[model samples]
Target chain A: MSDEVVTPLSHEECWQMLREEEFGRLAFRLVDEVHITPVNYAVDHDTLLFRTAAGNKLLSVAMGAEVAFEIDRYDDHHARSVVVRGGARILHEDEEHRADNVPLRPWVGTPKYNVVEITPRVVTGRAFRLTRPWLHLTLDGLGQE
Target chain B: MSDEVVTPLSHEECWQMLREEEFGRLAFRLVDEVHITPVNYAVDHDTLLFRTAAGNKLLSVAMGAEVAFEIDRYDDHHARSVVVRGGARILHEDEEHRADNVPLRPWVGTPKYNVVEITPRVVTGRAFRLTRPWLHLTLDGLGQE
Candidate 1:
């Protein structure tokens, strides 16, 4: 680990990057079982919304019903990732509210018969970078301040 | 439905493409929950072998654990995936063999801690292509002779 330097990005910057990302893999848990799937997501109001079928992923979610949803993005040069973890559950039972029904991108057929929402619990993130010999010297000099 | 006329790759072809891929994600049921991680892997003797710590992924695969390991690749032009649904367990003892300890890349950490081997029960796979206005057809044309 010696001779390597890493720059850190702030929470706000990481959150902004995550919000700008359009797709993410959903992580779920049921009776000690873990599963993940990639899907298009709508990110707004400090939460996430996902649409899935009543398949194994959803069926498993119903077993214990407590779940965590994560969203992240990595910058190429910086090699940084912003990950937001949260608790999720089926959307509130309100057929009158059309907010959950709006599909971010319409494909075909009925858009997601099941919709779930996740409210973030903890949002911790990190950034990694390479420090070549020359780069390391420059960074060390700058850190003296 | 008839535009550029690109054809869908067969399921067999999808499997081959998946094997050619060096990176895939492992979704495991956490002993008390579920966890998933993107892993770099190599096909060894026609089975799955990836390294991990004593995390949820391995705890869930103590001896004879049913799990799902999947490989997927897609772009705006096409999307294809190969999913392995089956049993998984540790391939070696707690100590890692020196030969398998090579790193994923110079920067990425080691690929050998304890190799997890997944023996699939049903390896279901499919491929899809989106060329605009055409229906999202499953790769039913596994037109293999």
Candidate 2:
């Protein structure tokens, strides 16, 4: 009903927001179809790390699937969104030791031994806020004029 | 940190959650790349309706792209996620008038004259909650036993 402004967030702002959010949606292809799943993750510098067990998600990662990860916060008056797109890979046996220190946790008690990471090839974000008009005129006054 | 349970919501339950949530993420492939964007949308019975102007979002829909729309709610102890994979199509000129009746509204003040619809071909959802083990034991007592 009111006017609004949509601003493109800077690269630094995008990363900042991504780091703050602990949960996001991961999208990848599975069984010749596109699937998106919400994942609890940790930000490891520029890449994202999440744990998943033997499921469609893990299978996709094994297939070298390109993925898109998105996280955002929204309220009645404002919304901020960030999207990270890149290839996802499972951490190798040697890299698993470092992942143990990353603090990634799964909501369910499902033992997520498979640690997957998405190295962002492209990152972008945008923010939207509502604004009000400076002058408020009565509908009756406008009609008379 | 504790035991948890993962429950599979039925089809009816999934639809109910979809209707209650007003915001979601839309995933589509563009230029051999997977891209996901947060969108404010309204559920139209078994389908999804959202408006977008002349942008990549609209272009992807115009090209008859298969898209994935995801909406979820999560907390520290629980998470519910629903994924809808379907084919997207722009509403025809003759059908534009009916689009006005839809509750879909864009957050920004952008003139989203293009009304796109995704008729879901597959809809699935799952929920996870925390649970505690029946025999909770102290760290020292467990080893002694």
Candidate 3:
């Protein structure tokens, strides 16, 4: 009772949407297990920037890990998603100073001493429209069908 | 200007919250690149159920791929996130029939020939509260802060 069309978004559209969102989920592998963390980040140029204190996320980056970052939005009728896959590296002292100038800040109140950057190698996005079956039924009852 | 306190959620609390959400982002590695897709899914006895047609997600599960599924909710003041690390597998014909009994449905309204199940090996979550520095400034101007 639901019908919708799924469409692939362009590269520019995906990047633009990514820049517009403030939060995303970062996925990585640690200790032979995959882990995902939701983080507040800012985009600078082509790199994604976020702060981290001492935690699994920091540990994974310290080991030079490959990660996936994703952000999405959905409503009853529409949905959009963007995914970025890349390697994460802790910024050097000089780079951190430059990043500090970029106004990158973490939502957590605690001070995050390290700045990590994910240089996305592949970015893809999908957009789709959905028609709820129940909604359709309701409309049919109202003689709108 | 964001200041927030992040609290680690307990296992029970995380699971409870996971069952409450209807949609999540699924992360997996395909062709050596990590990719994530937003999927509408349902929970069945601690397992995540979702549908996919002929796509990378279906192909990945057919290969017995490890995946990470994440769901989250956020507002101006608080955010909660849950991540499930698991292996994804396509249901066998018999299992497929059983899954049809579950309340699992796709949001895209497309005909998904394959039903996939993700058996989570580890689940974790975090909750945080943020006080926007800008909001504080506005409140201060009104003599409320």
Give the lDDT of residue B17 in candidate 3.
Answer: 73
State the weakest 10-residue window (summed lDDT) of model 2 chain A. Answer: A136-145
lDDT of 3 by residue, B10-129 (tens): 999888776666678887765545556687777788888887774654455435867888988776677788888888988776888655665556666666567788998888888887
Name the lDDT value of residue B61 in candidate 3. 44
Residue B16 of model 2: what lDDT?
79
Answer with 1 or 3, whichever has the higher lDDT.
3
Query: How many angstroms is residue B8 displaced in model 2 relative to the true structure, after the best TM-score fit?
Result: 1.1
Q: For this target, which candidate reaches the highest DockQ against the unseen true structure?
A: 3
Residue lDDT tens for model 2, A5-92: 7788899999977766767898876644566788877788778888777455445543476789998886546778898988898878
Off by over 4 Å in 3: A1-4, A54-58, A61-63, A134-145, B1-4, B55-58, B61-63, B134-145
Instruction: Report the alpha-carbon TM-score of model 3 versus the true structure.
Output: 0.81
Cα lDDT listed for each candidate: 0.50, 0.71, 0.71
Over A7-80, each residue of candidate 3 has an lDDT whose tens digit, in order, gives: 88899999987767767888776644556678777788999988778464445543476788888877667778
Top-TM-score structure, candidate number = 2
RMSD after CA superposition, every candidate: 10.7, 10.2, 7.0
For model 1, residues B1-145, the per-residue Cα lDDT tens digits are 2332233456567556545654565665645544445554555545666655545444545447666666655554455556665677776575345215432221134233556677666666544443322223323221111
Lowest lDDT sum, 10 consecutive residues, model 1 chain B, at B136-145
As a whole number from 0 to 100, the lDDT of residue A138 in candidate 1 is 27
